[model samples]
Target: MHLPIELDRDRAEPLQNQLYEQLRGLIIARRLKSNSRLVATRFLAEKLGISRTTVLLAYERLISEGYLETRPAVGTFVCAVLPDLVPAPQINDNRVDDLPQTELRPPLFQSRMPVGEPVEPALIDFWGGPDFRIFPLKIWQRITQHVLECYGKGISRPPPSAGIDPLRGAIADWLAAQRGIIVDRDQIIIVAGAQQAYNIAARLFLQRGDRVVIETPGHAGASFLFESLGATQHPVPVDEHGLLVDALPDGSTSLAYVTPSHQNPIGGTLPLERREALIEWARGAGAYLIEDDCDGDFRYRGMGPPSLKSLDPYGLVLYTGTFSKTLGAGLRLGYMVVPQELVASTVAVKTLLDNGSPWLEQMVLAEFIASGEYDRHLRRVRKTYLERRDCLIAALRLHFGDVQLAGVDTGTHLTWLLPASLPSAPAVQEAARQRGIGVYTVSESEIGGRPATLYTENALLLGYSSLEERQIRDGIAGLAAALRDHRRAATG
Candidate 1:
């Protein structure tokens, strides 16, 4: 009997494993009838152009699972009685499932962030990704080789609870040089990324029902993290000047998280005066200020403001920085500059959460920074992104006559406020998505519920870091056409 078996050699799954799964599937689906004789292992192997041993292994798995029975002399046959298979319990539209749910001490709220995936065939993905083609791969390979050669056994050495020393020093020096912030190496703790750093901060500071402040129309994932910790949100609205320091409540908060340098969702840079005000608020309230400087590196127009930590005198600021925007998200490396007072406690918490980030990346990054390749790479990418940003602006102008753009002078993306002529942000987003382009509204980026005001109702965030100039122009043009169609349909 010729079994309809198709194997993909290109796939990562082992050939034997694939064969076993396929045979089991066929039996479970009842395509392979009960008591039906299966082809001999040798014959099947010859027919499938695979080793006889591969076929034997597959057959053995099937027999062990009771999907097939091998007779002493008569040949292998499908089992007369198939083993019971139960469909897996599924989470329905409501989060609750048929399976028994576990009760926890404090009521928990599970949340997820909407991540953008860029498929190979995607039309025009504005999903925030680094152009790996521009990454310093040649230089990286050399540095990696040097690190490996210099420290053979050191690679396997258990990393410090804080981080590898050289990396911490490099990070400190880079912060001083680039971001105008100087700190001891002991204060910098390496994390998986900004998210992990946030997790550590949440654990260290927040208690049940504690109030933590976040910006209005801010990143949902950030706010949701605190929310899940049983903290009540004290949402302060964000304007062109970043987080409103005046709106912050007096003396009753644990932490206040802000993305001051190129604020997430809505790009706003807090001025020096406002930065000072925020510091004072934290100082007075006895609250820790969490400054997530994820996109601080990319500034187009002029020298951006000094980092919040740079302005810190009282040591209330916990400054966070990530390699995601600089190197790439795949690096999964970020660091937090904790207050000297909180250093020991935070590092102890980090040890419990995760021993340390991977050693190879730490070693390689240390070398990269020491060799000044990281700075060089940053300089190169900054120029490319500036050109791309300009192209996007020009394209939007060409398609829709001089549209209003915000956060243009800095960061990988700028917010475009839709004119009254165009449709709402969601309508435009959906229409553009159908055209194989992604134009995200602030609503799409929110992890928590939407804030009170609708500052970004008609605003769309366009990330230009990963896209080439041509791609940016084409994507804008497509979005323009999509918006026009939407407008016409609505009018009719």
Candidate 2:
């Protein structure tokens, strides 16, 4: 049988490591059947187009892991005495000493955040655009006022570490009803937003030098958070379909942070097959998967993919979400749901982070969501954003004449892949700035990522959720004119 092995030279993972990973995954997934003879290194390497030395190194490690064995004068075969493969027992206490398992190891500013009250910016900004127009301010105001009215000044006492009771309950219910993630309220920890959640997960699971994989051209805020904790960075490149799961290295890592729902700046969703493969990869490597669904709520594509948490059966996915995108960033409120295994450590570390998020906002949001006003609000915003997304597409097409755009299927921004006929992304961005229109390139839009010459150098990220149809049209028009002027100057 031809053993299934493939490698991508462009991947951030080393050739040997990628080879080691796929073989191990095949065994763990039971795709490479037990006692099956593997192909010889010389022949297999030639078949896969890799150096024979690379295959030998990968095989050596798998032998050490008991995934494969070589019988004298026979051939390499799956190990008869396979290591135990079962979910690790959950730790009942909050100690960092939990048994090894898929351990619960475990930033878009600029779409309209509030300043006391939200205001429209003077420049026609395309990034960080939040719909402040129909924010249901009256309901939010009433709920905030009611929380103070009922609780009096005594609401200042330290709230539960897990979160305010009603808020946690509301979030739990909302996840089940909308996202198909069912969990108890206690499993949720109210976070300041997604940023603090990343910090908390790092504190709980990441030891120094623990490898953390992040999507290339991913949210820089996430990469910075893990790096701050002294975790090593391993960046996996993303494509139009989403995170490339086959690139995950076969080694111990504390966590892998991915924006599967609408991959940060690129806006691609991982299909179910890749999601399942990723979960299996994590299971084999004994790492946790932090699934950040920052914009999963507003998917333009047909019936978006399910949350990784929803598909996780081995207790390997740490799901992080925020209201900053759906409601408003001013709320500064988000929540994370831990598998029952990691709840104790997660809450303990979260308490150390902030002692808990602000009490009043929790109470007010709890009331808003439970009373069903939050659902109504989402319905209003989703329709508006869908319309806004369509308008942006129409405007770009009209002005640029067959421009390439991405992330349109979800999230607030769409990446405009600059045509070869035009100048580079940075030049267009500068020209647009001169016209008082805000457009961001990969460097500004995504978290700290190594330059992907093809995507980052020639792409401009545009956010349209906060702009009106008229503004979207004018902004594209302004960019078109700026590009024309830039071309004229270059020629002269």
Candidate 3:
């Protein structure tokens, strides 16, 4: 049988490394069962349209990594004993040791949730979004009050479609310093939020019957938006490292929407290798890539990878970012950095779509960034979220041994693969719900297209940004108890 493997000749990553990663992912995910026979290198190479030497090198790497074993004169097969699924947490080369997972008192800003109170939810829901409790209410209020005192007149008049000059310039400066992107303010179009930013992008690049590439189990909102625009979507599967660039459609693709920096639902950060490959593919195919960096600012892994837009020299990337992940989603503020050619078109589209975002908020945000309070706020929240994430992971390990997780060491949320002893992800979700706790299956969350079976069948998405350490720990314990009750009921 032909293995489900594809290679991209245009990618900068070596074919051998590409093949090895795919095979390794499959093996780790258990798609290739223990002792499952692999086809001969010659046959596999021929099937994949690559040289036999490439296949041999990939196989050798897998063997050395303990994923496969070759029986002399017989055939190679998946190893009966695979490598440890729960390897030690990765420490970036720049860091000496992992951050302590201990829970510290939250910053003073996080002392109050929305409505100016610390009321806890009855269900203990871990709904994904910004933690409103951590919002810099005092600073934001001071800025808002100041902006109103100064620019209150502009609020009554219609704001510029592309955004106010101060905010745009401030955003440009912020991107240059934080994300290594040096685009002019004129190329930046502020919108209601990521939703509107995506809508603007979909309108510009997509037409009826146009082909759009989307990550499977990606942000459902993006898929729905493209579909509503009458663009036919092509689903590309994502592994732990984010979108499988090799699996991207070859040609006739008008646009490809990606969440390279902390993908929604799955939580994997796209590595530099695949980021380069994606850029190459977009350039060669003459298509546009939308890089959604919504959660890019909340990386726990020592100043994570650079934005994909930073690596794109071809003007093919449309970088979208939002404050919803940091500030409250209720604020509804987001921006998109477009190529020079599309700036006018995007501005026109923004003009037509609500004529721009709120003026007062934009003014306040501009001052917030210019004064460097935004950076300080991010540092505070990042530390808090990191502590919560670690607490959640530790809770899972405490309740369920050897917890297999994805998209860890970064992002506000992570994906957990339920052990075989537990029920399906949906079933687990139901059990958790019955116990007045919130957990989500891949499908129940904002998944874009159909996810791989490994994710859909067993993985549950958990968001830790909104939860405190105590809440995270309690939620996991409650979930574990719910699963136990569910299993007992099923057996009976």
Best-fitting candidate, scored by TM-score: 1
Per-residue C-alpha lDDT of model 2 across residues 461-483, encoded as one tens digit per residue: 88888888899889988989998
Question: Distance (Å) between predicted and true CA of 57, model 1?
Answer: 14
For each candidate, give its TM-score against the true structure.
0.80, 0.74, 0.74
Candidate 3: RMSD to truth? 27.3
lDDT of 3 by residue, 1-492 (tens): 557788888999999999998998777767788899999998898788889999999999899889899999999999998888624334487763444543343433221111212244437777656788899999999999898998789989988989999999999999999899999999989999888888888888888899998887777777777877778888888888899998988776889999988877688888889999999999888889999995888877767777888998899899999998888778888899999899999999999888788888899999999999999999999899988888998999999989899988777788998788788898888898898888777664332334455588888988888888888888999998998998889889
Predictions: Cα RMSD each: 9.1, 25.7, 27.3
Each model's backbone clash number: 2, 7, 1
Question: Model 3 — which ten-residue stretch has the worst lDDT?
Answer: 109-118
Worst 10 residues of 2 by lDDT: 109-118
| Candidate 1 ranges with C-alpha deviation above 4 Å | 1-109, 114-122, 445-448
lDDT of each: 0.84, 0.83, 0.84
